[model samples]
Target: MSIGVEEAYETAGMILFHNFDIRAVTLGVNLKDLIHPEAEKMCAAVEERLTRLGTRLVRQAQAVSGELGVPIINKRISITPAAWLIEPCPSPQAPLLLAQAINRAALAADVDFVGGFGALMHKASTQADRRLLESLPEALSRTQRLCAFANLASTSAGMNMDAVNQVARLLKEMAAASPDALACAKFVAFANAPEDNPFMAGAFHGPGEADACLNVGISGPGVVRAVVDKYPDCDLTMLSEIIRRTVFKITRAGEMVGRKLASLLGVSFGVVDISLAPTTAIGDSVGMILHGMGLERPGAPGTTAALALLIDAVKRGGAFASGNVGGLSGTFIPVSEDTAMIEAVECGALSLEKLEAMTAVCSVGLDMFAVPGDTPAHALAGIIADELAIGMVNNKTTGVRVIPAPGRQPGDCVDFGGLLGKAPVMRVSRFSGSNFVGRGGRMPAPIGALRN
Candidate 1:
C-alpha cells in the first residue's frame, strides 16, 4: 500500500488542512467462549480479556497513528452481545454486574468507549434479553464508557411492536435516571443494525464474526465539504463525480492506516466504514456540505435530495476504493454534532419530521436529537416505530438516539460538550399514538422480504 509522492502530498494536505482522520478504531472481541454459569467468573473472564486486548489496542493504535501521520480519534472495543453471555446466569442483577466489569476494563485499558451492552430481539425476546433490556437504565446510568443497543426490527423478521413499546418506556426511565438524559445517548434502537459497526451506542460483535477483528470508521466531512466548495458553478452531475473521486482518495488512506494497525496488533483487519461523521470543529460538518452544494441550510427545500446525492456518491466511492467497506458507511446527520444542523434546528428550518425524512437516505436514524422530557412514552414509541419501519421496508440499517432532556422545553438547549456537542431541544407532537402502538404484535415483514 505504498503511496506515490504526489499522493502522499495530497493525503497530507487532507489531514493538515481539512479534517480528514480515522474517527474510530474498534476491536471486536468475541466473549461467547468466556461465558460462565457464575456471573462473577464470567465477569472476571470478560474483564481479563478486555483489559489485555484493549491495552494492546490502545498502545499499537497510537503507534500506527503516529507512524502514518493520521489522527485516530477514538479507540474502542465491541464485544459479543451481552444477552448471550448473560443467558446462563441465574442472578437477576447479572446485567448490571457485567456492565460494571466492562466499564472497569475500559478504564484500565484507557479506551474511549466500549460497545455491546445490548441484545438482539428484532422478532422475539428471550428471558435473557428481557433481563438485559430491563437493566439498561441502571447499567448505563451507572457506567461511564459502556454503550448499549437493541435491534427491534429487521427486513426478514419485521417490526416487533412489543419490544418497541418496552424500549420506549425504558428510554423514559433511562432519561429520568440520568442527568440531562445523557444515559439515553448511550442507547440506540436499531432496525437491520450492522454487526461490525465501529461507532458508539450501536457497535456490537455479531455471533458470526471471528473471535477477534479490528474495524475502522473513517470520517472526512471537512474534506468532502472542501471539495464541494471548489466547484460552485458545476452542475449536480459533475458535482457528484467530484465528490466521489475525493471520497475514493479518503477511503484509500483509511484502508492503508487500518490494515497497518491491524497487522501491528496481530488481529484480522476488518472493514473501513467510510461514513462522513461530523464533529464540533469548525468546517467539519455534513450539513455544511449541503450548504456548499447550494442549499441555504440543511432541511431546506432540497435537503433530502442533496443528502441522497451526497450519500450515494460516498458509498460508490468507498466501494470502489476497498472491498472491505462495511458498517453504516454513509453520511451522518446528528443534530448536535454538526454545527450547521444545530443552527438549522434553532432557526426552525429543520423539524423532527424533516429529520425523519432525511434519515430515509442517511445512516443512523434520528441521531443525537433532544426533545422535551414530558413527551409521552407512546409518542416515543410512535417515533421509534416510524423510523424503524423505514429501515424494515427499505431493507437498510437505521437507528434512533433521542434524548428526552428533563425540564428542558422546545427551543431550549442542552450541552453535553465534547464530541456529543450542544443540542437545541426540538418539539415533539402533542398528539398521542397509544392506540396504534399499544396493539402489541409483529408488523409482519414487508412484501419485498419474500425475495427467495
Candidate 2:
C-alpha cells in the first residue's frame, strides 16, 4: 500500500500548515506479571519492565516519525491497572511506591507520560482498590510522569456512587496537595473506559489485551477546521462530506505510521485512535472547528447538533480508512487544552452546563475544566455522575478530568502551561446535590445493557 503522489502532496500540505501530527504512540505493556508479594521487589520488577519497553517505544516512534516526516509529538506507556498489581503488595504505601517506580521508568525511557496508576471500581471496591484510591492524592501529586484513572461506572455494571464519592473527595485533596492543582490534570474518572485508548489519563493495558501492543493517537483539529473553512458556503451535508474526506486521509496516515512503528518494534499493532485532539496552539482547536461551522462560537445555539455531525462523520471516515480504528475516535473538547474553548470560557460563551451538553455528543466528557475551590465534593460527584450517566444510557465511553482549582473562583484563570494549557474557572450551580450523591449505591444499568 504505497502512497500516491497526489495523496502524498495533500498530506504534506496538511502536515506543513494545519498542525497535523501523531499526538501519541502509546505502548501498552502488561505489568500484571510484575506483581510480587514484596513491595520492594515488585517495584524493581515494574521499573525494569517499563524501562526496557518504554525505551524501545520511544526509539521506534522517533524512527518512524523521521522516516515518514510526521511529527510524533508524544511517546507514552500504559501498563496494567495498578489495582491488580497492588493486591499482592504487603506495604500500605505500595501503590505510591509503584507509582514512583512507574515515574522513574518513564523518566529513564524519556517518555512523556505513563498511565494506569489507578483502579476499576465500577461495581465494587476491593481492599487493593481502596488502598489505590487512598493513595491517589499523594501518588499523583508526587509523581510527574505517572497518570491515573478510575473507572467509576460502566454500561454493564452500572455507576458506583460510593467509588464516585470517594474519588470526589480525593480530587479535592489532590488539588490542595499540589500547586495550581496540576496533579488533578493527570487524573480522570471514566465510564466504559477503553482498554486500548492511546490518549492519556484514561489509557490502560486492559486484562484482555496482549502482553505488548502499540496504539496510535492521531490529531488534526486544525486540518479539519481548515477544510471546513475552505467550504464556507456549503450546506451541512456538504460540510460533513468534506470533513469526512479529510479525516479519512488523516486516519490513513496514522494507520501507515502505526503499522510501520509496530513492525519495527516487533509488537502487535493495536489501533489508530483518530481523535481530533486539540492543543493550546492557535488554529488547532475543536471549538474553533465548531465555530467555523457557524455557531457564532462554541456553546452557542445548535452547537451540539454541529458537534454530533462532526463526530459521526469523523468516525465514519476513520472506520472506512482503517478497520483498526478504536478508542475514543471522535472530536475532543477539552476546555483548557484547546485555545478556542479557553477563549469561549473566558468570554462567557461556553459555560460548564453547555460543555457538559457538548460532551454528550463529543468523545470525552467535561475534560480539563476547572471550578471554584470551595465547590463541594458532592457537587463534583454530581457532575461526574451526570456525565457518566450519558455514557451509560448511550452505551459509549465518557469521562471527567475536571479540576477544582484551589483559591480560584468563577472567572479566574489557572495556568498549567504547555500542552496542559490554561483554564478559566467556570461557575457551577450553587444548588447542592449532596443528598442525591449521598444515596451511595449502584445506579442500575440502562435497559440497553441487556442487549446480550
Candidate 3:
C-alpha cells in the first residue's frame, strides 16, 4: 500500500521476469537539411544524411544493446514529416526520389521501416501536402522500407473533416494497390499527437520535437501474464495492486535500459514507452492474462471490465514509475502476434467483434492480425473507423493496424515471419460498409471531450 513511485518499483524488481525486457528504440531525424529545391541535390543530401544517421544509430545501439543484453529490435529512423520536405517539389517524381533514398538508407543500415513519409493537416492542407497525399500510393508501394502516414485530427482542433475524407479515399486506393493495404496500416492518422514515440508505422518526428530524439518502446507481456496467472482468485482491487507493482518493476527496467542506451549514444534521453507490447512468442498474450485471471475465455461477458481494470492499473503504475511514460502505453491485443490470443481465436474464445470492443481499452486495434482475404476494403475501413471513433470521443489514443491477408481465407494462416506474427485469417462481418464509409465527413467530435 505504499504510494512511493521509485521505491515501489525498487521493491517489485525482486520478482521481475515474464516482462522480459526488449525495446524498439526509434530515432527521429529532421530532414530539412536534405531539401535543396533542386531534385538532384536534394536527393543526394537526403541519402547522405540518412546513411550517416542510420550508421550512427545502428553502431551505438549495438554497443548499448549488447551491454544491456536487451536487443534493440530495430535501429529504425523517422524523418521530418515528408510533407515539409516536399512543400516545394515541382514534381511527384521528387517524392519518389526522396522516399527511395530514405528506404535504401534504412536498408543500408539494416533497419526494417523508415517512417515519416507523411503529411500533417489536421487543420489545413496545403498544395504540397496534397501532392504528397497524391504520391503516397506509389511511394509506399514502390519503396521497400518506406512507410506513409497523415495526421488528420487532434484534440485541440477537433477532427478534420477534409483530412478524414481524404484518408478514407487514400485507404481505398491503397487497398486496391496492395491486397494487405498494410501500406495503409503504415499510414496513421493521429489526435493529440506526441513528439517522441518510438513505434511505427505511426511514429513521426513532430514539428515541435528536437532536431533528433530517441524514444524507446519496451515489450513485456509474458512477464505480466505469468504474474497474474499466479493469483487466480485475487479480486479486482488486489489484482490492480499486484499488476501496478509488477508493471512498475518492468518500467524501471525499461528506464534503466533507455537511459543507459541514450547515454552511450550521447543523445539526451527521450521517453520510455512502457507499452505491454507482445511478440509472436508463446506466453505473450493479453487474452491469456485474462484467461489466467480466471476468465473462462478472453472475450466473454466480463472481458471489457477486466480489460479496463488491466489498462487503468497499467497506466497508474507506469505513470508513477517513469517521469515520462508516453507513446501508446496500454495493453496490445493483436491477435496473431501474441500466441495466446491466436489460440483464443482458434479455440472460439475470441472473436472479431470482441477484439473491436477490446480496442476501446487497448493501445492499437487489430494490429498486424490477419483477416479474411475476401473482406471488403470499406468494411475494413468501417472497422477501423469504429475503433478510431472510440479514441476520438473518449479522448484516449486508439489505432488499427489490420492486415487483410492476401489470398488467405479463414482457418488459413499468414506468416509475416518476424514481429508482424502469423495469424489465422479471422472472419469478418459478412456485410458491406460501402454506404457508411462513403459518408467520409468528420463524426463531429463528441460533446464534453475534456477528460484529461
lDDT (Cα, 0-100) at 240 in candidate 2: 88
lDDT of 3 by residue, 286-336 (tens): 777888777887777889888889888888888899997987787777776
Better of 1 and 2 by lDDT: 1
lDDT of 1 by residue, 195-234 (tens): 9999997999998799899999999999999999999999
Off by over 4 Å in 2: 1-7
Better of 1 and 3 by lDDT: 1
User: Lowest lDDT 10-mer window, candidate 2?
Assistant: 6-15
Error of 2 at 340 (Å): 0.9
Each model's C-alpha lDDT? 0.94, 0.92, 0.73
lDDT for position 130 in model 3:
83
C-alpha lDDT of candidate 3 relative to the true structure = 0.73
Give the alpha carbon lDDT tens digit for every residue of 13-86 in model 2.
78898899999999999987878999989999999999998999888888899998889999999989999998
Worst lDDT 10-window in candidate 3: 10-19
Name the best candidate (by lDDT): 1
lDDT of 2: 0.92
Structure candidate 1, residue pairs in collision: none
